[model samples]
Each structure stands twice: as C-alpha cells, then as structure tokens.
Target: MPVEEHDPFEDQFASALRQAGGTFESHRLDLAARGETRGRKIRRRRAAIAGGVTGVALVGLGGALVLPGIQTDGGRRHSVAGSPSAPPTPAASPTRPSAMSADDVVRTLERLLPKGKFSGEEGRGTGEQLPPYARVVYDDGKGKAAVAVMVDRVRPGGSQALETTACPDKVFVPYDACTSGRLADGSTLMILQGYEYPDRRVDTKLWSAELVTPKGQHISVQEWNAPAEKGAPVSRSRPPLSPDQLKMLAGAAAWRSVADAIPADPRVPTAEPSRSQGVPGGSVSATLATLLPKGAEVVKKGVADPGFGYVVIDDGKGASMVQVNVQADMSGLANQLFGSGSRTLPDGTRVATHQGPGDKGGRGVVMWTVDTMRPDGRRVVISAFNSGTQHTPATREAPALTPKQMETIATSERWFSRD
Candidate 1:
C-alpha cells in the first residue's frame, strides 16, 4: 500500500510540544513516541483508503512537508527545517562547538546559488532555536523562486538515511521524476522533481536534493517554482536550480561544517545499531507474495519497509492493489483499534473487517480490509482496493480479494514465522 500522507494533527501536536518544551531530552522523547503513533496511523489510513487494512508503513515525502526532525536508528535525529520556537538551552559542555551565526548561514546560501538577486532571506544558526537552515527568494532573471537549505545529522547507514535518499513511491507521491545513488564520497543522494502538492491541486513545482554522508551529515536543498513553498502563485514553470545545481548545493562542504558544529544529544547512543535489527525477518513484499492467492499477476510492488508492503495485481479483470502490514507489540492498541465489534478466535486472536468507500479522494473506489492480531501482540492487516492506485478512479467494482480471502491472509501463521 502507498505510505500515508502527513497528518495535520501530528504537525499541530509537534508544534505544541516544541512551544511547551522544558528540556530538549524530554521533548525529544515525547515527540518520538507521538511520531511513532502518527506513523502507524498514517500507514493504516493510507492502506484503508486505498484498499482495506491499516498499519505502520514506510514514511513518504508527501508534498515535501518539512519535519522538525527525522528520527533514525540509535536515536539519531536530523531536521528538515528550522523551527521558530525558542529552543531549550543546552547544558554547558567543555567540548561544545561554537554555534554558527544566522548571517553566516544566509551568506553561505547566497554564495552557493547562481548569480541571482536575493530577497526575503531568512536563516537560523546551528544550536539556535532549531537546526541550521537558510531560505531565500531568488530571481535568476528568468523568474523568482524560493530556495532553502537545511543541514543536520542522521544515523549513518540507518533506515532514515536510506529513506531520505530513496525515491518516493509513485502510488503515494506522484512526481515527474526522481533519481538516487551514492556519490564518490560514500554519500547517498536523491534528487526529486515533483510538485508541492501530491494531488497536483496547484502547478507549483517542488524540487529537492537530499544528501546523507557516511559520517552522518545530512544536507537538504529544496526549490519551488513560486516565490514560496506554498500560498504563492507560480512564478516560473519550474524551480531555478537544475538537478546538477541542487546536487552541488547539497554536497557543499560548508553544510558539513555546520552540521558538525551542532551539539550531539546526550541521550543518543554512540554505537549505532544495524538497520535490520528489531525489524521483521525478510521483506514484507516477499512474504506477501508467498501469501497471495493463485492466478494474480503482479504488476508492481512497493519497497519493503519494517512492517509494510503492497502490490498491484491483475486477475484479467482490472488492476487492483493489495497491501499488508505486520506489526509486533501492538496489544496496547488492541482495545482502541479492535473495539467491541471485533470477533475473537479460539486462539484468542482479534479480528475485524470493514468495507467502505476510499477516503483518499478517489472516485468510485472502494476499500476492503481484514485486520487481525494475535494474543502475543503480533498484528497483521491486509487490505485490497478496486483501483490500481488510491488517487485514481476505480477501474473495477471490487478488490481482487474477497473478505474471506483477506481474513485468511491476515491470520496466516507465515507472518510470525521465519520459514
């Protein structure tokens, strides 16, 4: 299934948390818990709207929305944009690096850009209210566009680093084009050419380059066709910076220096854990493929995430989408999710099913879902949609899988077994 779109509620909650911050450590812990919950909700809702099940899926860059911080394995974190709210004062450390000045950040950005007239410049220095970042409206004699750069740290070789450099799934995020690969310096880079809106409600283009180094420095550079990321008319057909320009800007050494100067959170562990640790054995897509009923021709498959996978199939009638999420330790959410309408099996597994119109603005689309959870808190959710994608009109009357088939798949023992 397509990854869930950003939740407005989570954004509001995060903003509220930042504003009410006491210590950075406390805020980070609270936000991390909230983020995990929001992530689960997003996955569940996205699959439900597109097909039927709800669970945690991979994170997608829906509309390129700026997150306060991107959390990774080993408690590493990075910011995509600097916040305006006042930050908690850092405890004095003898080795604490001097903070970068806000002016220095803006100057570096201006210098990196091609010859252009800049206005509405804004910046936040390292170790300030938030991570270091620079934003400006630039006129390159062609048209005015908004450009921004943010620098921080990530867990080297962690899932967040991989996700940042991976192209978003077209099913969830419709983009013109995207490319990702590793640089000579062992840094992964991704350049995305997409619109500011996933639905293309507006033509304003949003192009971005994200680079994550082996040493954990992360640099993100974004450009918009309009003079602002949102709430502005398109000033040009596209952003000013070409893909090559964006790569150069994101790989600049200055950003690395800025990243290095940021103080490390004491709560984060020094030893990084393997990205695959604690995740389900094998890929979700691989396991889903084994569980699929006969005669369904797979057309496309979603990238594997910790607990999520999806596939588009055709049974010679029309294209349909099926997605599954396998999450562990979800017993805490059972009462809230299953409710009284759910049924209990002899094995003490809870099961719930639903059929409804898709909530993702797709026309004439229907989603069917079967959700199941074992007594051990191992939850498996499977959903199928009548359409190949959630954003498009329905191509079939119903999903390829019936409610009974989905229920069987959701309750299969293969989800928890390595074999």
Candidate 2:
C-alpha cells in the first residue's frame, strides 16, 4: 500500500511560517498518530499570529504568496522571534547589519543551508576590512548570485561568510533562497535567507541578503535597497577587493573581523521620524468620495498594515494610491496628488501610487514611505518614486528616485500631522 498523504494544512502551515520569516524546526511538530488535520489548522493559526497577518480579504486572486498570513505588499511583521505585539523599540538606531565571528558565522551558515541534490560548489575567500566587518565570499555557480559575508575584523574572532541556498524547493531547509526578477539594466537579482549567529544575540537570526550580478557585489539585503520611492536609486559600488584582499586586510582573522563589524541596519535614510512621534497604535481609513476628485470613489481598504496600508481607490480615470502607509487609511490629506493612489497590475499585484501616473489615463503626484524596525532594531525601508509613467507589469520599467530626492523626502517635516 502507498504511504498515507499527510494533511495539506500542516504542510502549508509550516511553509507559511518559513516564508513569514519564522524558523520552525521539524521536531517542533508533534503529529505522530495525532488528529493530523486539527494539528495543521492550529499550526497555520500560530504562524498567522507570529507573522502579524494583515487581514487580506482575498477575493478570487492568486499570485505567489497571496496567502493568509504574509503581508501581500512585501512588508512583514518585524517582531522578535517569539513575541506577538510590535517588537520592543530596540535601544540603538535599528536597521544595521549584525557583527559575528568568522568561524561561528560560517558554521552557522552551513547549518542553515538546505541539504543534498544541489549542484553548486562552495569555496571560501577572505576580503579587506569592509568597515564594521571583514568579508568572505561564497558562490555556487547558478546564475551570478553569490554570497558575501561581512564580519568585524578588529575582534580576534570576527569573520563572516554569506552564501546561497537552493530555490523552488518544497520544505523549509537552511539556505533556501530566491530572487526578484531582472531590472531594466541587464542585472540578475537574487534574495538569500539564512540563519545568522552573531556575538551579541545567542538565538539564530534570520536575515535577507541581496546578491547583484556582473562582478558579484554584495550588500546587506536591507541596505542595498533605498527606503523611499522618491529617493535616487542606489547603485552598487565596485566589487570590493577580491577574497585575497579580504584576507590581507584582516590577516588570519579577517572573517572574524568582518563578521564582528557587520553594522546594524541603517536608519531610514529618508526624513527620519522624531522620537516624539512614535508608531501609532491604530490605522486610518477614509471613503473615496471624501478624498478623490469627482468620479473617483474609494474601494474597500485592505486589512490594516502597520508598515503600510493598501486601499482600492477608483475614478473612471483609473485607481491608484492617494497615500500609502502615511495613515491607517486615507482620511486626512489637504492635497490629493492624483499620482498618489493605488493601482492593480494586470498580474493582480497591488502597488501604492507614488510619483507616477495616478492610473491609466490618471494624473497627479503622491508621496509616502515605509520604514520597518526588525525585532533586533534593524530597519527596512520602501519609499515612493516620483515621475510620470503608466504603471506596468515590467519590474525594470518602474521609475527610480534620486539621492537628493531621497534626502528631501527623508527630511519632510509633516509626515504624521493629523491635519
């Protein structure tokens, strides 16, 4: 007889937790001879709570990860590994890379990597001191995506290595990874996820890593991308000194040096929020009739998202975001930037309007930003990019924000005013 198939709910539950950035080892599940179906539903509910589900009223829609718990708009809850409510506002400026030891970093990375059947090679090389850390590179030839680990070199034991895991797999294994599509400029993009063992934190840390092509330049997954859509797009600097240079810089302890020095996530480069203005306890929403020009009507608001809110606003002209993440909803705004609305792509992906067209045939300007503090205080940013262009499905087609623009938006004084 064929082996019995397990309940799909349990499998989906484990998968969601992994995707939501949770680490649930296999041993944690106790389904042995137990009512498997009940266990699966319970598992999903737990994952939803852990990831902070933003009630997505899923109408007949299907896109990757358009599931129950994950944030449909790319942002996720940045909570401590175990807590439910907003992660404690970490003490230091959150959003920097972690510092660790070379040996520990590599060993931790290896443990996190998925096992077997992969066809890539793993080689290690050191790098020159790259500030807060030294560097080690890991590349298993499968496209240009490679891993660049940064460590704190000054500390005798500091050293770190970044590597890639296989993609499109079924179970949650160490080092499993994937990437965003290619940009207009001929570059392949990939995202890496792995367990990090830093000197400061004892528990395994899960972090996102972005690998950019051509010369294999690597930056913290969080730092490589800018925080605002209006800001100048950031370009990767030349590939840092080769692995040889890394070793020379840190000497025998380069890995440790780099690992220990990997800085915490950077501050939201845009106009930073004042300590006086804290994250709000609730969200805001408004009817389309109240805010948009005539013909434009407000569709239902997406479930409240702490980092960003999604509303379906429409006019015969088309619908797009009037404001994003600025409020729980779009109740207060003196000026309506037609450009600032929400739009749904042919593929069914919903994007907040920034500095682009209001919608097909729509017009106006809208601006906003998203800054998330990781459980450990590291930050992730997504800002609006202003420009005139129709929203299209192509990733390369999106207009980019300039550096000066980024600074201006970062410094904007009236982001949270209740007017």
Top lDDT model: 1
Give lDDT: candidate 1, residue 69.
34
- For candidate 2, write residues 1-419 as lDDT tens digits: 00012112332332233223322211221111111122223222222222233222211011112333322222312212233422222332334233333344445433333332221222111211112111122223222112223212111111111112113111112332344444354323334332221111222222343223332222222111111111223222222223233222222233333333333222212222222211244332332113334453555453332333323444433433332223222111112211245333353322332232222312232333422222222222233322211122212222233333332332232234344
Candidate 2 regions exceeding 4 Å error are 1-144, 150-275, 278-281, 284-310, 324-419
Candidate 1 has what TM-score?
A: 0.76
lDDT of 1 by residue, 1-419 (tens): 23223333322222222233322222222110111222332222222211111112222111112324332222212232234533544654565555776678888999989998998776656765345667778999999988877676767986556766777677756678899999999999988897665557678787888789999887877788998766899999889999999999999988898888776654445554333211356766677777789998899886655566778889999998888767676665577558767899999999988787753544677878788879987777777889886656788899999999888888888777776
TM per prediction: 0.76, 0.26
Model 1: residues >4 Å from true position, as ranges? 1-97, 101-103, 128-130, 272-280, 303-306, 355-359
TM-score of 2: 0.26
lDDT of 1: 0.65
Summed backbone clashes in each candidate are: 3, 75
